[model samples]
Target chain A: MSFINYAAREINVKIVYYGPGLCGKTTNLQYIYERSNPQQKGRLISLATETDRTLFFDFLPLDLGTVRGFKTRFHLYTVPGQVFYDASRKLILKGVDGVVFVADSQEARMDANVESLRNLEDNLRENGFELKAIPYVLQFNKRDLPTAVSVDEMYRLLNYKGEPTYEAIAPQGMGVFETLKAVAKQVLYELRRK
Target chain B: MDAGLVMYEEEFDRITSILNRLRVESSANIVFLVDKNGQQIAGAGEIDRVDTTSLASLTAGNVAATDGLAKLIGEKEFSILFHEGKKDNIHISIVGQRLILVVIFDERSSLGLVRLRVRKAAAEIERVLTQMEAKAKEVGAMEAASPFAEITDEDIDALFSE
Candidate 1:
């Protein structure tokens, strides 16, 4: 849910990066945290396990410049992508304003991608939101790998809504900003419509 | 998820007053109200050293996780959560269905007293939020013409222009 605080002159939106395990969800956040100017961002908090896997979520607050006198703050979060963490994933999506599905673009992870997508839909439904109605984008990550699936094939399986999709090599920061901007724009546009 | 929150000046003032009163009466170091979705609505008391944005987010996450656990145990929901630290402690409770009231205190107060004051404060906060939601629905039509509605794609692109 977007919180428009007219009194504070701040508009806060929650955007969650979601996908299967090791699909570059955390990398997407880390790239943004590294590239954003210090003044434009807050501390990036990662709640992960000993093996460096995301245990709960990763949170980064980015202050995109003001729009119509209201400062735009997007609190970006990434859900733990492992299958057994469904409870944690549902908790993270409680009040999401937008979503970026970071699908692993490797042929071997196709089943994981499809399962995660179905999980996203079910979780969104449980939270009273329909996937089609929310501001959503797709990020086909791991594009630098030789084993990565073709963008066309990934789209055919995942881009059911034909939402804005991008190819990302998250570690190298490729398509990170593009994905962020696409989702942010859609969220802002949705806010205006309300 | 019901709708975006729109807080008018009067509603904000009333809610802040209640929070401030709760802080004083409960002897809490800080008190704040956040939506169930993790947005800091209003806060009171000593907050300079506190990172409220992150606190709000984590508190909401904690509540949601706890609620899930409650469901697994055959409960409708767990409406209150308390975490005790060595010197400081946090008490979180649900206000209505869409807001969370959090109180942070130290050795200055006992959990018993904080809980008492929070119970009273939560009632008032819930009333205020209920009215605010009603007012939002009433004025929501006019929001279509608000200044935010004037934002353009160029404005968004300009944000990343450095």
Candidate 2:
């Protein structure tokens, strides 16, 4: 849910990066954290296992300066993409304002992508939100991989809603900000429409 | 705006004062109010000593995880959570069913005292939240335009401008 603090002159919104295991959800957050100026970003907290896989969630709070007089802050979160972490993912989606489905573009992970999308829909419903009614986008990550499937096929399978889609190499920082921007823009537009 | 939490200056001050009073009455090191979604609404008592942003986010996440556990166990909700640390003990409770009330106390105060103060404060905070919700609806209906209505594409683009 979007939080508008009229007293503080701040607008806080949440955007969750979601996908199957190793779909570069955390990588997208890491790249953004590395690129953002210290004044624009807070510490990136990762609740991960000893092996570095996200056990709970990765949180990055970005201060996008201000629009009008309200300081717009986006709390970016990434769920534990592994299947058994579905409970953690559902918790993270409780009050999400926007979502970025970071689909691994490799042909081998096609099934994972589909299953994760279905999971996203179901979890969203559990939280009283419908995927189609929220500010959402698709990021076809790992485009740099030689085994990556074609963007057209990824879109054919994933972008059923025809929402904004970005081709990304998340670790290389390609399309990371673009994917974020697309969803953030949608969120702002929705806020104004309210 | 629908179902989202909007904090106006008036209600924020009222809530902050309650927190301030709770901090003093409970002899707590710090006290803060966070929305269930992890937004820091108001804080009191040595807030600078803690990272309020991370604290709020993590606290909300903890509450959320606990709620999940509650559902799995066939409970309606946990409602209250407490963590006993070596020095500073933390107490968290759901207020108004939408806000999280968190108090960090230490050897200076006992859990019973903190819980007592929190129980009283939660009632006041819930009343304020109810007023906040009603006030928000009143303003929303009268205005017919959001504060963001004046924001343009150019404004949004400028936010991303390096």
Candidate 3:
């Protein structure tokens, strides 16, 4: 959800990065955190297990300077993508304003991608939100892999809403900003509509 | 539930004052208000030394996790949570089921004092929150004329123009 403070002249919005395990959800956030100006970003927090897998969520808060008169802040979160972490995933989606579904582009991971998308829809529903009603985008990550499936096929399987989709190699920072910009734009536009 | 929360000047002042009062009454090191979505609304007391934003986000996450535990145990919700540390303690409570009230105290203050003060502050905060909600609903009509309404694609693109 977005929080607008007239007294503070600030607008804070929440955006969630969601996908299956090893699909680069945390990597996407890490890239953004490394590239962001230190003055414009908060600490990158990850509630992870000893193995470094996200156990709960990864959080990054970014300040996008001023938009109009209000300082725009975006809080980015990534849910634990392991299937057994459904409860944690649902909790993370509670007040989400936008979603970035990072799908593994390899041909072998297509089923995992589809399952994760369905899980996302179900989790969002439990939070009283629908995929079609919220600002959402898809990122086909791991595009540099030799076995990466075509973007068209990934979309045909996963993009039921036909939301904007990006091809990314998150470890290399490819298409990272582009995906963020697209979802952030949609969120801002949605706020104006509201 | 509303998809957004807007804090007007009047309600902001009221909340800040309540937090400030609670800080003094409870002898707290700091007190801040956070929404369920982890946005820090207002803070008072010695806040400069702490990172309010990170604390706010983590506080919300903690509350949400507790809520999940409550559900599993066949409970509606746990309205309050307290964490006792060696030197510092944190008292977290939900106000109006929409906002979180957090009080950080050290050895100088007792839990009983903080709890009592929080109960009083929660009531006052609840009243102000009710008013703020109503005001937000009324402002919905004015949103059509908001600066955001006039924002163009170019303006959005310009944010990342660097």
Candidate 4:
């Protein structure tokens, strides 16, 4: 839910980077934090386990230039990729402005990716926002990995029709901003349309 | 408004610098400032990975609910909520009357440092925000001078059409 401040003349939107465990969800954020101008980005917060597994979520706030005169700020988030943290994941999706599904390209994690996408939809449904209603994008990550599945294979398995998707090697920063911009554009387009 | 309460570009930049300095000095992963209702005001660090928006909203919701529950039991609003899960621990503290400052850290960052850094940042943030809010309210008051101040019924629908 956005808090409209007529004073700042800016609209703030919250976008979440969600995916299965070890799918480079965190790495994507690390890459963004590394490359983004310090002035435009915020601290990356990760709630991970004692062993360093993400337990709750991670956060970063970013400013995506401007639309009209409004400085658009997006609050990015990643839910813990571990399967059992479904409750926490649901909590994170409440009132989300958009979603970036980071699907692992590894053939082995196919089930996890599908399951995670399904869970994303289920959670959205529970919040009264369906997969179609929410502005969402896809990132096929870990392209540098040798055992990574082909783009065609991943697409066939993790099918989300009509939404913009990207092929990313998130660690090396490939397709990071492209993905962010696409979704941000969609969000602003939605805002402008309103 | 207090003249000393301004958070201009220079002041805002200084605060961002302070956030990074503290994060690096403290070795914390995520640190952020959110309004009383869970809207993020400013933040620093590997922020793209976490969900600060929901964190802000949920943290506010959690605090409010707990406070409500506490009131029913004849207690004041809870000031902080520290949750230690199996892997991560969350330190949620109210910053002045305006916002909540949240810091999430792993074993790499020491608890004592996070506590110390957050304590110092909270005071400055409170002062900065108090001033910003006042300025914002002033601007809002001025906007009422517009003819569109009397927005029509169809305008509301058109505004949310997207």
Off by over 4 Å in 1: B142-146
In candidate 3 chain A, where is summed lDDT lowest over 10 consecutive residues?
A: A63-72
Ranking by TM-score: 2, 3, 1, 4
Candidate 2 segments whose C-alpha is farther than 4 A from its true place: none
Task: Write down the TM-score for model 1.
Answer: 0.97
Q: What's the i-RMS of each model?
A: 1.5, 1.8, 1.3, 11.1
DockQ of all predictions against the true structure, Cα-based? 0.69, 0.70, 0.71, 0.06
Q: Which of the two candidates, 3 or 4, achieves a greater TM-score against the reference?
A: 3
Q: If both were scored by TM-score, which would come out higher, candidate 1 or candidate 2?
A: 2
Residues A1-194, model 2: lDDT tens digits: 99999999999999999999999999999999999999999889999999999999999999988888899999999999999999999999989999999999999999999999999999999899999999999999999899999988888999958799999998899999999999999999999988
| Interface quality of candidate 3 as DockQ | 0.71
Q: Which scores greater on DockQ, model 2 or model 3?
A: 3
Count the clashes in each prediction. 0, 1, 0, 24
lDDT of 1 by residue, B1-162 (tens): 587787877988999999999999999999999998888899999988888888988888888888889989999888999999999999999999889999999999999999999999999988888898887877776556245787887887788777
Write model 4 residue lDDT over B6-72, tens digit each, in one string. Answer: 1335446655776777678778887776765356666788888775665775675566556556677
Q: What lDDT does each candidate get?
A: 0.91, 0.94, 0.92, 0.72
Better of 2 and 4 by TM-score: 2
Better of 2 and 3 by lDDT: 2
Q: Write the per-residue lDDT of candidate 3 for residues A76-167, one digit (tens) a residue.
A: 99999999999989999988999999999999989999999999999999899999899999999999999999888888999968899999
Candidate 4 chain A TM is 0.95
Q: Considering only chain A, what is the TM-score of each predicted structure?
A: 0.99, 0.99, 0.98, 0.95
